[model samples]
Every structure is written in C-alpha cells, then in structure tokens.
Target: MNAAANAPRKLPGPVRAVGRRLPRMPASIAFATALNLTLRRKFPADVLDRLEGHTFAIVVEDAGVELLFRVRARRFVPVAQAAEPVLRFRAVAWDYATLAAREADPDTLFFNRRLLVEGDTEIALLVKNTLDTIDIPRTRGILRRVLRAAAPGGG
Candidate 1:
C-alpha cells in the first residue's frame, strides 16, 4: 500500500472543531439521560434494581471524556463530579461505538485489550454480561450512524 493508504485520514475542520467541543460538553449528563431511558426500557425493573447504589465510570480514552453514574430510585443517574467510582470502564471512542453498535463483541474487545475495566471486577463483569445479553436494534442502529458520521473520511 502507498503512504496515502496507510496514513490516517483527518476529519474536516468543522467536524474536528465539533469533536473538540464534545468532551467539554455535559457528557456525563447526556450519557446518563440516554442510558436512563434506553436501559430502563430494555431491561426489567428487577434487573436494574439489583444494581442500585452501584457507581460506574465510563472513560472514553480517545475522546477524553469521563462519566460517572449510579442507580437511584430505579433510575440511572450521573454521579456528582466529586463522587468516587466503584467500577470504571475504559475504551477508545471508535471501539466503544462498535461495541454498542453490536459490530464488536465484549469478549473480543476485552481479549484484545481494546476495552478495559478497573475497580470492582464483579460489577464490571456484571455490566459486560448484561450488555452482551441485551438487544436494542434501534439504539444500535443510531449509534452506528453517528459513529460513521464522526469517523475520519466518513463525511
């Protein structure tokens, strides 16, 4: 392959600017809101109820976003900024998008070290297993489109 083929494509200036601002935005709030609605609808009340009071952090390494969350009143909410997390998951943006889109399996990503889990191992495994079992076609489709749009050279 030529150098051009091997080179990383850059996003357009405007898209790059938007990407830069995304991390600074209320990422935790947005994430919590989205998950609160979707997870609640997809999973049973009893299932989510078991995770009550558990705090988890999602660290998007490439995007430089860290969001902490917890379960309260059977609703998932973003933890306060100062809250210490019990379980933390770390992955690059693209990897996470594909994982959410169902293009990548959790075990595959974990085996490859593309995704990482820190803190409470039991809770981490529980989340991974829960995510693996759920099938949200609509949400996955939306995530696929959003990721494609944000990808370098996609536009």
Candidate 2:
C-alpha cells in the first residue's frame, strides 16, 4: 500500500496537532504557486513578465479570497508592509478553489458573500474580471478530480 493509505487516520483534533508540528509554506505562497502554474498560459505576457516585483495582498475571510496584484514600471519590491491592501477580499478555501477551476460562478460567489472584493475597486475588478477570462491548465484535471472525489458527495 502507498504510504498515505498505510498512515493512521486521526480525528480533527489530532490532525490539527500533527499539522502544527509539520513545516509548511505560508498558505498565500502555496496558493500563489498554484495560481501561477494553472494560469501561466492564460496570463498576459506583459503581466507574467512583470509579476515578480508586484506587491499585492490576498485577503481571505469567511466569504472568499481576493487578489490585489499590480505591475509597476519601477523595480519590483514589496512596499506595503502594513498599509491597507490595494486589493482585499474574503472567501472560504473551497469556494476560491472552485472559482479558480471554473466550476463555480463568480457572480454567485460575490452575491452570496462567498467572495467579497475591497480596496482599489477598479483594480480589483480588473483583476477579478481578467481571472474569470482565463482557464486553468489541463494538468489541473487530475488534481481537480482528486479534490472532487475527496469532497463530500464528490462535489
């Protein structure tokens, strides 16, 4: 059997305890990596070329997740250490992943408070609308199917 299949299953509390002991990248970094990989082809060349130095915040609340990304002419550096976000949002992890995979409607998410956008409304809209236009790469199919299978009732 695979290592995972042989591993012991723990309840939520024990799972949390184990999780706390493991080393993990920040959730934001993990999410960003997935985004970059899934949308690399759809990303405007100009945007991808300039993404390295951009400063943006991803705010996630009970509602959903919002990304506030921008490309500046100046050299890349993160400026806002504590300032209010240029873009902000909130959403549950599942809803955010669903939207990313194009399995859920952005409008429905926004209206249901499963997603909320704030900060630089114009920029936020631009980012959100642009993301809506892009499609996740085919590699996501395997991962997506696995996720759906693991979800309650298989999504």
User: What is the Cα root-mean-square deviation between model 1 and the actual structure?
Assistant: 5.3
lDDT (CA) for every model shown? Answer: 0.71, 0.53
Top-TM-score candidate index: 1
**In candidate 2, where is summed lDDT lowest over 10 consecutive residues?**
1-10
lDDT of 2 by residue, 64-155 (tens): 22334434442222232435655666655455556655667777767666567766776666667778777656755665775577565776
Q: Tell me the tens digit of each residue's lDDT in model 1 across 1-155.
A: 12112223333456545655675337778888989777777766776777888888887765556777788888878765535677888876667777778766677667667678878777777777888788898888898788667666765
Q: What is the lDDT of residue 134 in candidate 2?
A: 74
TM-scores of the models, in the order given: 0.76, 0.61
Look at candidate 2 and give me any clashing residue pairs.
53-76, 61-90, 63-91, 63-114, 64-90, 64-91, 65-91
TM-score of 1: 0.76
lDDT of 1: 0.71
